[model samples]
Target: MSFFSVKGLSKHFGGLVANNSIDLDVEKGEIRGVIGPNGAGKTTFFNVVSGFYTPTSGTVEFKGKVISGLHSSKIAKLGAVRTFQRAALFPEFTVLENVIIARHLNADTSLLNAIFRHNTKAEAGNLARSKEIIEFLGLKDEQDNLALNLSHGHQRVLGVAMALATEPELLMLDEPVAGMNSSEKAVMVGLIKKIRDTWGITVLLVEHDMKTVMSLCDKITVLDFGEKLAEGLPEEIINNDKVIEAYLGADDIVA
Candidate 1:
């Protein structure tokens, strides 16, 4: 089995079918990008696979375990975590604090451990790991700053840092570089590459920026009108006529 995959997955909101039997297979340590036009069901697919939404049919498998309909927290505990289009963090918390809090997934919550303070070692380890994540994401300089005090780009990076703190085997990102300037996008692009190469983490992202998607992904999947439109290497996808016509107008083909 691949590291992460969704087979015949579909999601429906009332009578509206957001995702219609979409199938995606992502190998371990690969950076996969999902792109589509507005209402292509890209976000719905991400939500269903990440456990934010339940599939109307089919299944989501991670590490060969069927995880469809699992709670989001349980799914995260199983080593798959995802980020949202907007930065998700505690606004009043310092960057370090926010990340440290996210490490709770790995923390000991047993009553005995808590009452006896036997989790001291665990807490210390979480702190060190959180700091490592902060530095790895280049948020070390702003570790002491409140999350809301950081710039938009930094906030987005902080969200990534929080996700990394979970030590996931599969990291799902939704529009990771959304609302960023060119330099910020470049930084995020490099950071994502390092996240995969250095950490050996598998990445599955849905993004709108064709350039970022082309540059970062090992494979690209295209969706249109709630169904799979195309799937191939970045080069293949860019040149695919169906993809060009569906995702971007033929006249405005992606370079």
Candidate 2:
């Protein structure tokens, strides 16, 4: 079995079907990319995997467990975590605090212990883990900086660091470099590969930057208007006639 797998996944809202019977799989420690034009149900797929919406019909199995209808927090605790398209950070919190808060998802200490000043092994251990994540994300220098004070690129990195703090086995990123400049995108691409290699985490990313996706992904899946259009390696996907038609136009393909 793959590290994560979705079978016949579908989602609908009233009369509109946002996703229609999509099957996808991500092997452990692999970087898989999902691409398509706008409104291709890429975000919808992420939502289903992240538990924002339960599939109308289908199954999502992660690491051999079913996670189709679990709440977002429950899914997160199951070693599957995802980030948003836009940076979601606590504007009032320092970068360090934001990362530490994410680690609290797995904290074992009770509120009573903290309130009564009782020392617990879990609390101590969690602190050490958070510190390691801070260093891993290269935020040691800006640890004291408030989220609002950071540049857009750093803010995006902070958001990713928060998700990584969850220590997920499968990390799903939604357009991690959507609005980044060329240089910033380059940095993020390197960061992503490092995360995959060093941490041995599987990644599923939905991004619009075709060149980056083609270069970075081990495999690519293409969606068109909420349906699966193609799935293959980067070179094959790039040369796919159907994918070309979807991205450009049928008339363009004909011409």
TM-score of each: 0.93, 0.92
For model 2, name the residue pairs that clash.
Answer: none
How far in Å is the alpha carbon of 131 misplaced in model 2? 2.1
TM-score of 1: 0.93
Give candidate 1 misplaced runs (Cα > 4 Å). 109-119, 250-255
TM-score of 2: 0.92
lDDT of candidate 1 over 1-255, digit per residue (tens):
888878999999999999999999999999999998888998899889878998999999999999999999889989899999888889998998888777775444433443343667766676788888999888889999999999999999998898888889999999988889999999999999999999999999999888999899999999998999999999999899998778767343233
Q: Pick the candidate with the highest lDDT.
A: 1
lDDT scores in order: 0.88, 0.86
- Native-to-model Cα distance after best TM-score fit, residue 167 in candidate 1, in Å: 0.8
Off by over 4 Å in 2: 110-120, 248-255
Per-prediction backbone clash count:
0, 0
Position 117, candidate 2: lDDT: 38
Q: What are the per-residue Cα lDDT tens digits for candidate 2 across 18-123?
A: 8999999889999999988888899999999899998999999999999999998999999999999999898998887787677775444554543453567866
Q: Indicate which candidate wins on TM-score.
A: 1
